[model samples]
Target: MIAWPPKAAPRIQPIGAERSAECAAIHAASFLHPWQEADFEQLFVGPGTVADGAIEEKEERLAGFIISRIAADEAEILTLAVAPNWRRRGVATQLLAPHLAALAVNRASSIFLEVEAENAAALALYANFGFEKVGERKSYYRAAGAEPKPALVMRRVLL
Candidate 1:
């Protein structure tokens, strides 16, 4: 069974360029096409990049991280991943909740993302938070352990 982080005391912190390597490692373990260190480095320095990490108190290790950027009236979730060992905890919720709230505070009209169509767990998570399918990209992602898969494009309008 997949073990999850303890839910009661998880914490979230802004992730900076210093932790790019660690973030890259976690991304590698948790994703099929994880971003490289250089990619995160660019993101940290890029015009609209914003990112955060979820950590358990005392250990200071990354339980999950979310990468997003605000562009005008929209916020895009570029990537969000939880360590395989940390799946099912409230870590993803913790990481995304504040970011989405912040975007709403900034008057963001909506948020959008693309995920592999077969990622049921992610689709459910996003759906629970009110994201809806807006479109699709054919063969958008390389499957977890197989060839590429179709991508579902989803969006959530801030109200």
Candidate 2:
């Protein structure tokens, strides 16, 4: 989730309902429990939803994407995913920087997200960006053959 940016800078672009298929593809490839294309499409058109994708300029492919929902002065990051090939290359950092600014512009004073408790890289990245430990959701992530990792809810003051 905290993938560093690579040598080539990714171009950040608004992702609308039309790109739900591509978003679903990345989500399926990245998560154990992936949200479907319909889910992405719904979110894309949902009230207060904001979505963006990081595109690799070199290949003209999506490197990663982030989606969030804003309600009043608060916001929550729905998902942040990086393509397998783009992991550890800093796409998350690049995507989040501009996204946070947009949230502030939208008058969001605080933002939140949930991540696996064991995801050190993501925790570190969030911490670096001023997010703090908030609450936890037990067994938030589960697999058919594996134990679940608790989800840590983190919050950051954006404005």
Highest lDDT against the true fold, candidate:
2
TM-score for each candidate, following the candidate numbering: 0.89, 0.91
Clash pairs, candidate 1, are none
Tens digits of per-residue lDDT for model 2, 1-159: 344543687899878888788889999998888999999989999999988899888877888999999999999999999888778877888889999998898999999999999988789888988999989999999999999779999999976
- Alpha carbon lDDT of each predicted model: 0.83, 0.89
Runs off by more than 4 Å, candidate 2: 1-7
lDDT of 1 by residue, 1-159 (tens): 334534555688778888788789988997867789988888988877778888767677888889888899898999998887778876787788887887788777899999989889899889988999999998777656777689999999996
Residue 158, candidate 1: C-alpha displacement in angstroms: 0.9
Question: Which regions of candidate 1 deviate over 4 angstroms?
Answer: 1-8, 143-146
